[model samples]
Target: MNHAWIDGRPGSEPEAVAAAAALIGGSRLPVVTGLATDIAGIRAALGLARIAGAVIDHQASAAIYPAVTAIRDSGMMIGAPAEIRRRADRVLIVGDAFATSPDLPDFLFRHEPDLGKATRGKREIRWLGGPESSADIPGAIEPVVCPADGIADALAMIRAAAAGHRFGEGPIAGEQAEAVAAWMKEAGFGCAIFAVAGMDELAIEMLAGLVFDLNAETRFTSLPLFGPGQAFGAALAATWTTGFPLRVGFGRGFADHDPDLHEAGQLIASGEADLAIHVSGLAGAASPEPEWSGRLPVIAIGGGAASWANPPKIRFDAAMAGRDHDGVLHNERFGSFVPFAATQTGTLPRAADLLAAIAAALGDVTTGAAA
Candidate 1:
């Protein structure tokens, strides 16, 4: 069966791989993005980037960067999901965290923390800027409805209240501030849960500050939700191989990282990148923006290409990790890389194989490091 296409027509895998190689070899600057794949697939894509002198970035970089930047700029007290679930008596959901992580509500509220009979009191769940409905969420939850952008302001006020020094007026004021402050002071173990998507760096930093303030009086930590793409897996692979996260370039024959300069979207839009190789193997993954492919030659690989409204110049259908093929992935719930078995055997080509083939076609040997 033909799994490769040239201009949307069925073609041999070798021909498609060669065509992709020619485009990458011929371009002055190429970019590899949409890194929504397993560890092996991501490593293979990174290898191709190194040989082709390309920039590497993930599709969810915009969403993932806030937490990364916050952690980098100001240190954070982070806790794993298991720890949060087992110990936290108070959970503060910042923003609409449940939007991206649907399992969070159940994971947190299905049962009380199993610390012991002494600390097995009802878990108090509060939402800083969460959804209105508590129908889906188990047990009683307090939703602090406020403007989406005002999350930072609310967090600042909460922090000031908890610290016993009022920091001027803001969205959360007076009694509400004092009440949340009292709540924080009373909690033995608390966690601030937030999603990076739709959250700015300032908000995350402010949330981190709140966690720190709570830590001064009690045990508290922050947990940022990650998802949609296997972004964590991608970052892990890229960092292990290149000693840098996404938004790295191999133009200087060595890995260099600059968040703004090497951004895949900006590079593609500004025409700095002459070619794009998008690799995504997740099932039901969205296609690259039309503007991206419209601006430059694109070679899209993996099951995600099926969603492209306008087919890229070259496309290859590949196996979806954890579904079509057995693969290892970063399981957020466990907070570690875990092996997943395929539910059913699939005939689709594996993304790692396809990427390795393209790298080989470039006439450069590629090597992968254990991730």
Candidate 2:
């Protein structure tokens, strides 16, 4: 198969798709096609979802519907970082606790403590430990004794406290859980931010089953500090344009979305997305399939001459995300916007911008929210 590769930079989805489509017509990775909304990386992945019979997955998975359902079914609360930094005295960071970078504790105590904002005052800070005690809280500060494993017990206790009740069983029950519950009840204003950790293993639907249960009784909110650069931006853009996130299929001449039924990974893995219109930047997350189905045809559009055994021959070229054009990225520490500084390593294509070009090439690819 002659592969037509498109350089899928961070902001060039439309261009990448159009380029690949001009050659191969459609793709098979339904999940990759699903990101074709107005945002996420370059955001047109949603447009190609059904055409390729691929599942449109967010960087995580295609089951973003459950996340939406969770939000709608169980109302949530929110406080921006600006608010948390200026006003939140006690910050609770939990889930998949890994490395305790030096700057984290420093940010809570040193920087956030003295914000210039007058209305939102600052106060004492505490680091709620994750499974691993990565954050080096000083001896003086008491790290919330997050059990090595029993997060559910702690969560149930918190739930009980939030609901004006108490459960005496479980590891986090009794005094400890009560103490957290009391804190929740008393805090003038508090924020709880959730990430992919709570249930990255399960689909967003199943994950929501647990999360909604938490939101049922609490004033706390859950926000995914996302993975993949511009991930939130992508989700926001996609939903705005199409009313949904990843796993939009565009194969049947229009768009169709279903998280469980159409994940790109599953599609390609299952040999469904026979012709892959892959738009990737070196930095962003791509599918981690151990091998591409032997029959799969990949029109890989990107900015590298990288080779892989899975596809045997992947047509590729140079592309840009943070390079070539000034782009937008959020810092790792906090989701602070960082302006990209483009260097004229001036290689090949910009993935998102390329996708925009592809849209133009394909001509009149509708938003097709109705489809």
Candidate 3:
């Protein structure tokens, strides 16, 4: 009677759909709808949850919603994924690293690091020789490897130097930052890829302002990596539907996004959020303890085969976003959507489908009302 024991049950769309319907008090029968999320794994959960008439929440909730709020409060620009893959001649990966970014290993060289016919090529206007030696040094684009801890001073120093003001002049701050500032001034078209590792949520808006300032000197842009899995989709969808992304809640007949109030972990820990419809594929298991996982009615959804032999109190299994589900993901390169596919062979659904279903089921609930 309990299909939860079926290993990775959601590997099959049919099973995923059935599981979703169960969560939202729907039937086990088939449902045709679209669930979409910019994040990879959560996309599938969205599809499943929508069919289930359950709420849709992406795993990226922890990282993205805050950034979305910051962006809303401050303001942001537009530079898509295609731009990175095609036009990013010089790429500066700051703060964090992409887990499986295909473009990494010698991507920005005069020609892409390729062995096709042993031919060397240079795509960009000029080829900056050698690997990136520093983050502060201009044209010396490189990965920061800050691991979420060593970002603040580096960012702060860079910001100060770029602003033509001297902030810190220590070993890592003096020559290092000035070098990067010089590079920014020299770069024809540059983009800085930032992530939430070393800095807290409060620093995001300031980070945005810093990036914007760098632009005054040259082509400086910032790409904040939401997190593993479809970080962008969950954040973006929630924001679009309710004016805020990720950690937002619809328990009060209106969707609301707030760090102090809307964080999923905080809300659940405080007994604020009920009927949590969690979406993730990073790790298919849910929290064992209510405090750890948040004490609430959770409809956790995920990708691959169902990993939990016995899911959380209330749960559903979904498909993969990048590996299996058919949908779009924001490329870490330029903030554009990159569409990937999945099949019945591998488990994956899209957040769009799931959200659509939930919207359909909670028909009377306005996007704002869901807040």
Candidate 4:
């Protein structure tokens, strides 16, 4: 089966790779986005971007950045899933985190805490700033329903109360905030879980500050939910390689980090990026067409059998990790890389292999030009 395409026409894999390399070789500025691959694939992308002097961005950078920036700007106390599962006696969930997190149910209900309060025994779950009903959840939960826009103010009040100070007026009443703070202070170990999507940087920083304040009296930490793609994995790889997170550029022959300047969507929309290389190799639901599609020339590498709604100019299919081949991926429960065996073997190309091939082809193009 022909797994490559040029201008939407079927072609051999080598043809697609050569065409993609030619485009990258000729472009003044290329943006590599849609980084939904595993660690190896992301590292290969970083290598390609360095070689081609491209800007690197992940599809979910918007969701991942708030937490990252908050942590970088103001240090936060964070813990892994195993730590929360084993010892966290009180869990304070903020925003629609539970709705977005698929493993929240398993974290909340599937397992019992091993070390907690001797008096209560079971963990106490309190949800803040989301739906009013906890009916969807399996266990008993106390819901502090606040308006979506008022979450930041409510968190501020909570932070004040946690710090033994009183706020006269706020989104959350002084009495309620104090009551919540009292509960938090009574915990043996506390954990605050939040999702960064649709949340502003200030709000995330406030939540982190609240966790920090809570830590003054008792052990407290926070966990941020990741994304629709392998955002955390990509960010992790980028941090280690470039000394920065995602949204890095290599145009100056060294890695430079700038969240606003290197954003893929803005770069494509503003006509700064002449070409875009999109890599989406994770298997599950259909990947959404990027909003910046058709704005510039594009080379797309997608999951083995997945097809895009808006096909780019050049396309190549690659094997998906954990589905078509054995691979390592970030596990939220473990808060680390974990290996998974492939459910089925496939002859399709791997993303890392395809990316390495494109990089090699780009090198060949540069060598010919120099000669």
- TM-scores, one per candidate: 0.91, 0.71, 0.63, 0.94
Q: lDDT, candidate 3, residue 66?
A: 53
Comparing candidate 3 with candidate 4, which one achieves the higher TM-score?
4
By how many angstroms RMSD does model 1 differ from the true structure? 3.7
Q: State the lDDT of candidate 1 residue by residue for 192-263, as single tens digits.
A: 888888689999998888888777778888888777678866776777788777889999999998889999
Q: Write the per-residue lDDT of candidate 4 for residues 195-240, one digit (tens) a residue.
A: 8885688889998888888777788888887755789888889999
Clashing pairs in 1: none
Best by TM-score: 4
Candidate 3: tens digits of C-alpha lDDT, residues 134-155? 3323333343333344455566
After the best TM-score superposition of candidate 3, give how far the Cα of residue 249 lies from its true spot, in angstroms: 2.7
lDDT value, residue 219 of candidate 2: 33
Once fitted onto the true fold, the runs of candidate 4 whose alpha carbons sit more than 4 angstroms away are 116-120, 304-310
The superposed Cα distance between candidate 4 and the true structure at residue 313, in angstroms, equals 2.3
RMSD values for the candidates in order, in angstroms, are 3.7, 6.6, 8.1, 2.0
Instruction: Please report, in order, the local distance difference test score of every candidate based on alpha carbons.
Output: 0.82, 0.47, 0.47, 0.84
User: What lDDT score goes with residue 274 in model 4?
Assistant: 93
Candidate 2 similarity to native, TM-score = 0.71
Error of 3 at 70 (Å): 3.9
Query: What shift in Å separates residue 334 of candidate 1 from its native position after superposition?
Result: 2.7
